[model samples]
Target: MQTTSTYKILVVDDDPDIVELLHYNLTKEGYEVEQAENGKKAIDTAVAFKPDVILMDVMMPVLDGIAACRQLREMPEFRQTHIIFLTARAEEFSEVAAFEAGADDFITKPIKPRALLSRLAAYARRDAQQEGLDEVIEIAGLRIDRTSYAVYKGDEKIILPKKEFELLAFLAAKPNKVFSRDELLNNVWGTDVYVIARTVDVHIRKVREKIGEEYIRTIKGVGYKFNTD
Candidate 1:
C-alpha cells in the first residue's frame, strides 16, 4: 500500500505475531501504521490515531471486531473511515455479520501482502477523490456541492455514502455522456482495485433512489449516464 505518511492505518488483533507482521509490512509500504491488541483498544487507538483505515480481526480478547466496527460506525468521525475485517472466518454468516456491522470491506485470512496492499489502495484512492472534489455541479434541479460534500435535489438535501456520491459526481461531471461499466469502475473505483462490474449497478441504483429516478439513465447493453431531461 505504498501510501504517504498522511494516510494512517490501524491494525487490530489479539495475536502479537499478526500485529507485528502487519505493522512491519504497512510501515515498509510507506504508510504510517498503528496497532491495537483487542477491539476495546482498537476504538481508543482509532480515536487518537485518526487513521484513514482499520484492519480488524473478528476474534479478540476484550472485544470482537464486529462489535468494535458497529461502535465506530456510530461515531461521526469514523463514518467514512474504511474498515476491513481481516479475519480467518470465511463462513457466509461471518460475511453477513461484518457487513451488518458497517464494514466497508472484508478479507479472509492468509492473504498475501501484495493483495492486501492492492485492496487498501482502492480505499485510499476513493478517499482521496472524495476529499479532492472541489467543483459545485448543478444539473437541472439537482445540486452537488463538492466543497461541503453534499447533494441537493432542489431545496431538499440528499445524503449518500462515499461510493454513491463519487459515482454520481463522476457521471454528472459531464452530463449526458455515456460511460461503460469498465470506465466507471476505473474512474470511480480506481483501476487498481478489482471490483466486479455489477458493483457499479448497485451504486447507481442507490443514487437514483436518493436523488431521483429521472436523474440517471441506464443504457441497456452499455453503461449509464446522468440526465437532466
Candidate 2:
C-alpha cells in the first residue's frame, strides 16, 4: 500500500457497500478519505474538505456524477482538481458524456483494488511532478507564472484555459524539444486519462490561435516542437 498521508480524497457513491469499501481501502493506503452518499453531499463535503481527488459515482440520488463534476469545474478552486468517474455503463457515449462534463478519468464498475491503487498512484506522480516544476518560466519574450496561473506575451497578459496554459507551459519549459502527443497527454492529463490523440491537436490549435503560430511548430508525421527562434 502506498502512503499518501498528505493527500485528501473524497469518495461519492449512493451504494453503502461501495462507499465503505473505498473508504476502508483508501484509509488503509494512508490517504485522508472522506465519503458522501450522494452528489449533493459530495459537493458540500468538497467545499469544506477541499480534496485533491474525487471518486464519484455516475448514478445517485438528487445529483448525478456528471452534474456534480460540471458544478465543481465551474468553481475556480476545483479547476485543477482530479475528478474520476465510476461508471457501470460501458457504452462509448457514456464515457464521452463524462469527459464532456469535466471528468478527468473513469473507473469501470466492480473496481479492483489494484487498478484503483494504480490510478491513485498515477495522480500522485502527476501531482509530485507538477510540484517540482519551476513556478516561473521566461523565454522567447514569453513569461509564465505557474503560481498565479498567468501567461504574458512580452508586456501583454494573455488569458488561457487551465489545460491550454498547462500545455503551453509544459512545452515552453524545454524549448526546442519535440514532444509526441502521447507525452503531452501523459504529462498534462495524467496517464490514466482516456482522451483521444486529437485532444492534443485541438489544444495546440487553440494555443497557436491565441499566442501566434511562431511559438509552436508542427512536424508532420512526427510531433510538435516549441521554437524560441
User: The CA-based lDDT of model 1 is what?
Assistant: 0.81
RMSD in Å for model 1: 3.8
**How large is the C-alpha RMSD of every model relative to the true structure?**
3.8, 3.6
Question: Model 2: residues >4 Å from true position, as ranges?
Answer: 1-3, 139-142, 152-164, 189-221, 225-229
lDDT over C-alpha atoms for residue 190 of model 1: 77
Error of 2 at 209 (Å): 8.1
Model 2 Cα lDDT, one tens digit per residue, 55-118: 9999899999999988987787887787889979867677767766767677789988778988
lDDT at 136, model 2: 96
User: Residue by residue across 101-211, what tens digits does model 1's lDDT show?
Assistant: 766666887867888888887777666666666578887787897755579987787766555777888899889999999999888867666545666776787677777
lDDT of 1 at 189: 68
How accurate locally, in lDDT, is each candidate? 0.81, 0.84
